[model samples]
Target: MNKYKLYSSTDFLNDDSFVEWLLKSDHDAEMFWDTFVEEHPEKKNEIEEAVEIYNHFKFTSEDLTLEEVFAIWNNVKHKSVEKRFSFLTVLKYAAVFVLVFTTGALSYYLYNNATEETEFTIAENKPLNFNEAQIILSDGKSVPLNSKESEIKYDATGEQVIIDNDTIRQAKKEAEPTINRVVIPYGKSSQVTLSDGTQVWLNAGSQLVYPSVFKERQREVLLIGEAYFNVAHNAKVPFVVRTEHADIEVLGTSFDVLAYPDDKMFQTILVTGSVSIETKSKGLLSGKNKMVLEPNQMFYLDKESGVNYVNNVDVATYTSWKEGMFDCDKLDLSRVVRRLERYYNKQIHIKDPLIGTYKISGKLDLKGDISEVLDVIQSFVPIDWGKQQNGDYFIVKPY
Candidate 1:
């Protein structure tokens, strides 16, 4: 149940969970509304009013594949504005639908209009510090993965960590299994095939920690940075990805998790299947701390403040880094420079903060030199830069 006590039609309809239940018959929605009505009969009239508005909109989600949903959304995109509510109706509100029973199955609804063919653009973000990938084994051996296509695989018996025939480390089954870690620094990334056939692409400056083998009922891993997961489905066993801000309960899905420790926001984008992101909080006025995400939806969490938001976005933009390419749609110059700074391990100072808000879009291959990459960005936007005597680069809006 939403803790704020939704009393308006816009509040109820804006909630993805309410829409899911109304359109898809979600069980949690079924249970939640029933209990909410019983507890607060006074607000019964407002709940019904919200339902009436939802019926007027006539959105449907029965057996529609993700592609079809987007197609329908695109077809109606122009029409939504023509209608009475307009897209303004979907603007920011706390759905807050997850309670103890419902939180387990909660999924958030995103607010993105970009399709797969659509480019992604993010601006004003900072960079990382890295140059290569390293595998830190349980036995204290450090193996360098210098190749672009570096692959690491662990055996099911918790026996070996293999990069080709080279065994980075080995542990006896009789001994206590020590967890291993993979470190991928900026300017480089690596892929790992877990024993269960699950594939993960660790993005630049990301770290993944997991046991050498599966743990009976659960397959859990910790991420200090970003990664793309194609979780091998085992209905009896659930795969969970843990980060500093939230716990992503994998529901047999392919998704991307961006949770860098230095970054303030934690993001998860679902490409296929379903997943629930759960956050915990205490206080009388706090809403149920859960939001389940659907495919093509991205959930964003503000780490320091514990605020949550969801948006519909293209899956390719975030996942394309795994393909050795980076796509920015309309991202601001500040964020683009940050990414470049990490990739090149250099300093880029933007003297005018307003200049960083300028938007640009392009696709750049990671194989290019940092200067060449910066040159590409420069061609599209009105900006100038020069290097100082001490080697730091200063970016400024021309006089």
Candidate 2:
């Protein structure tokens, strides 16, 4: 049996001060509480009681005198003795008893204070920072669709490319023009709505080099990182996404590509429609090596061996981020932290290596508060997190 620590009334009072520190400081106090509860289950009841008192104090401006505070403490002590519950009593009962009394006092205060104005101000809105990729023309000039710009018509091609409100728009033209190579920097993502109205969502630290317009023969795009594509159907013009090791050709489909340069494998998950992937380096373009995928199928290419494998998976798990949710299906801690880093734009350091291997499966709404999301994750994982000097989080596997 694990030896549990018992928190006395004094300890409960000290915890009130800790709650104040938790709210004022930038650290993730809820994560701390989660780990603390796991380690000291015996004190969980006392800690919850302290939390109720702290919250009650926070909502009221009337400060209790030291004498009044002592009196209240004595009242609580007397009730504990009168109840004469066993020391091994369940934590939930104690928490409920403490909360009931605290809530009674809070209700009385709120009812008597008629002049106290309680207005809720909406929290400050933080706009989503989208990463964008740009196409740098062959000339010294660059076409930056992610930046604000006025519409300009190309004198040579007569094709209209509008850069406004930090978005790039390409108007359909009679003739498709050739485009030069472009690079996408890290921490940025850009979208290209194809001539057929297909949308592509690019991930951060990735690049796609393509022409200004596609030719009649074939529409080809070079991918370096991760991107999601809703390909336009044109039997005459096949849509081909080319990476370093393999090429994915599709007639009309929606799929996600994960081919980060540093990663060991390139993954292509088909959400809808069908796609054929071919490997040029392995000289395995033969029917035996070529892999075809249907909806809900994922194809992975090993970087070292140039071998491809296909598996069935849940399509929503890969596409959830586009819909403003974090969906993880048995994902390891490292992968979870990686997605969090991108979403929050913060660096994370895991103090314990073993923690990275812990698998997690859940879907968290990105539209909610970050702390709420963190609290939900803490409920499932055995770890503690706190803010670092640079406003990032330091995650540690608790003993």
Candidate 3:
């Protein structure tokens, strides 16, 4: 199947067809599994190990209540035909167990196992590049923001004010809500506070279009690129973030959204509270569907395939960019470089494409010079860089 390949052990373990075959001996699933087994017999060991992992973390082991366990088992019994039960079938049921529970919301959650020893293909292209940060105030006056420290703050009375030291930035005449747009260019970041007390850390190359004050029942904002938001809780008012790829609705949550338009994917990582994400992609059975995310879970939507997958991740790894640090655990070199390109507003071409497959662990501070970061990277990996006449960088295997 063009749609099928090994994303990770977690992918297959949480696959629908695989789970169907496990629980119900579904006809199509049986065919796929039979063909898969015939083709890649070597992965049988891995498949078995994934099954063991599922069983170990079953509802009984997790925080699921006894009623949940009993309800799921009842469904399992109905799914299983009157035919004799096999040990393999039982294993399948356990391996794909996470799919059984779905939130009542119109969203879907695809979970992953984090323990796979797999090298994933990473996107390296960066096309949403820009040069400067700006604030478009209500009077149509554009105030330039510096890369060092650019910030904005507004209040419920619809007042706008810039927060860079030694700067005179103010807005007057606010009897109603007014839209304010803040654009943060690549190589820089910013911070903003909405009138509702919601705080947002705008990442490099991001644009946030928000209202100067909250109105009525909802607080909505439009985002491009990436941002981390700690929404102020108001039970009567909901906070929503709209991206090109998805719409995230929340009551109150701390979450990070990475929706760089040029990248091959859109990603969201939930740090705390809950969120319901609605994709513009129309659904088959539901007409339109949404995907709900729990804390510490990350979702990546492949732009080309329109297929999104979720996995467990260290929340800090994705959210740390706002803190001027890049935290990764065995992340692909190409992906790391892509992020650096955005943060530095520089282009880096890897002379040896194979080096992109290399993975690095740990964290690096992004507040330093680009050359300094490269030096640290080279110290860890056998790589070096040369600057081109055009000011772009070329990374190569050191002499």
Candidate 4:
């Protein structure tokens, strides 16, 4: 018999009837059984029991002879049963085996295969961690704040208080303009009180450019990534937030803007007060393309189509980050990853394309470590996470 035949035949050793038939057969059959038992000493008892049952089946049933059983065993072992018997005849033999074994061996085999360990490789591309906050003076110089020897200076402009603690001195200007940019790099965030008494929360990997002070007409600030603003009500001066895709203008209201250059859509959500959004042409804001937004309304602009849509949503989900939590409702995996990247300061890659379309709804404690967030998500998906050569953590599908 071929060695492969013996290996395959071992699968049937647990079947009692097959063992009995093999034991009553000729010397060649007995030699095969002995060799199998010698090769698998761990299954010696099971092999002996199977052989006893085969002998019983051959002798107890007068219809079956030793020669007939041996021929059937040889036919099955060589896979030549098709030449000797029709499909119906083979089915009858199979029915006898099923009656004796009850498919116990096959069931166990399938169970083992189903429980086998599968490994998935997740790409390591996590979010960026902006840890340093700095202010760019009107003279094009960057001054790092949060330093130890910084003195806090107080500058009062109307009702707004400017804390110029040496590390960040407010650029003093009187109307003749210059563009002063405040950069919040990776791994850092900063809070700025604009000249209009509006409070601005700048997230990591973002930059805000504004004049030294607000002019007489409008309060304007250019944003790169994401920010939440609580505008001071000055009915006369409309506060304008400028991003690559759209411009948001409000009289005095609280709102959030998500305008990452890599994002496919620019979103603005109003919590309190009213605002107007203007989509830029060729990525530049100008003219009559402005759309107004009321309280509790969100303005969404498709980055590619240049089309704007308005909808109502639970505002808390958008503003939860400021409160140290991430609350999402039915958001896609890609959108969730984007938020994670901004919060953790690392890049993330989803190796499994199917994961991108997976929709999730949950609240995460933003104050917790990034790994905790990943673990929470892993509960629903089969993901493998690891670091890359560039030191970013990426998530991928498991095999």
Compared with the true structure, the alpha-carbon lDDT of candidate 4 equals 0.63
Report lDDT (CA) for all predictions.
0.69, 0.61, 0.72, 0.63
Q: Which stretches of candidate 1 lie over 4 Å from their true place?
A: 1-132, 282-288, 389-391
- Regarding lDDT, does 2 or 4 come out ahead? 4
For model 2, what is the error of residue 298's alpha carbon versus the real structure, in angstroms, after optimal superposition? 0.5
- Candidate 2 lDDT, 1-399, residue by residue in tens: 122255653475665545454455335655665777888777778777766776665331233432244335544544665665653454358675454343321100101112532211111122111244445442223555553212222222313444443433444334324343334454344565644556676665665555555555657777767888999888787788877657788999999998876677789999989999876533322222467899999998876655678899998998776666778999998888876765555677788889899899989786565566667777889988778888877778765
Q: Write the per-residue lDDT of candidate 3 for residues 101-124, one digit (tens) a residue.
A: 221111111111234221111111
Best-fitting candidate, scored by TM-score? 3
Clashes per candidate (backbone, < 3 Å): 17, 5, 4, 29
Model 4 lDDT at residue 159? 24
Weakest ten-residue segment in model 1 by summed lDDT: 116-125
Q: Which stretches of candidate 3 lie over 4 Å from their true place?
A: 1-130, 165-177, 282-287
Highest-lDDT candidate: 3
lDDT of 3: 0.72
lDDT value, residue 398 of candidate 2: 66
TM-score of each: 0.64, 0.57, 0.65, 0.60
